[model samples]
Target: MSIPYQLILTFISGGIICVIAQLLIDLTRLTPARILVLYVSVGVLIYAVGAFDPMKDIFGAGVTVPLIGFGANIAKGVREAVEKEGLLGALTGGLTASSAGITAALLCGLFASVLFKTKSKRM
Candidate 1:
């Protein structure tokens, strides 16, 4: 497939996920963190059940491009940990695999917080 097509597919998939998340937030009272965890869990479960492989094969990172991809990384990390460190891998793999993304997000948030000014309330 062309790179453009691949990107389009990935964007659509990611957008759909975002829309679903928004709907859940608007319709219910779930916290953003809970919704995020739910998406990751669903992705892992789908991958575990042998369902997400074909999509992954077709889209490559496109299928794994969203928070779903993060979950997949965790699953992969756990599997690797099991292979290398046995029990320790299970705990470390997920965090290790997703660390880069987490770091980037944190760095961005920190930068925004530093650069942006807020109005102070007068007593």
Candidate 2:
């Protein structure tokens, strides 16, 4: 049996993204939070330059499952909202587009917290 080409591409793309993050962690002074913000900002910039869709087409979920994808989704939502709802879209579009994911994250966190016991780390 042969692996599908798309699967290979997806793996490579996602792996590369992860590798970059790992390298940042190993080599840089920047905190993880800053890296996360940087990635999301880069995503917005990519979308602003009209490159996100083509990259998404090529990379599939590899491009859409990361923080960058979240950023792009927000940009996309805002753009569509602005087109349909005028100025108000700017205020609501990102949250509107991201609501489902946000809700899922919240629900999952709630479930996890209820199911597990936590201890404070002694740092």
Best by TM-score: 2
Compared with the true structure, all predictions reach lDDT values of 0.82, 0.88
Alpha-carbon shift of residue 73 in model 1 (angstroms): 0.9
lDDT of 1 by residue, 1-123 (tens): 898998887777767778888999989978999998898998877766776778786667766877787887778777788899989887888889888999999999999999998789999
Clashing pairs in 1: none
Residues 3-38, model 2: lDDT tens digits: 487778878998898789889988986789988898
lDDT score, residue 64, model 1? Answer: 84
TM-score of each: 0.74, 0.88
* Models, CA RMSD each: 3.8, 2.8
Per-residue lDDT, model 2, residue 77, is: 91
**Top model number, lDDT:** 2
Weakest lDDT window of 10 consecutive positions for candidate 1 = 57-66
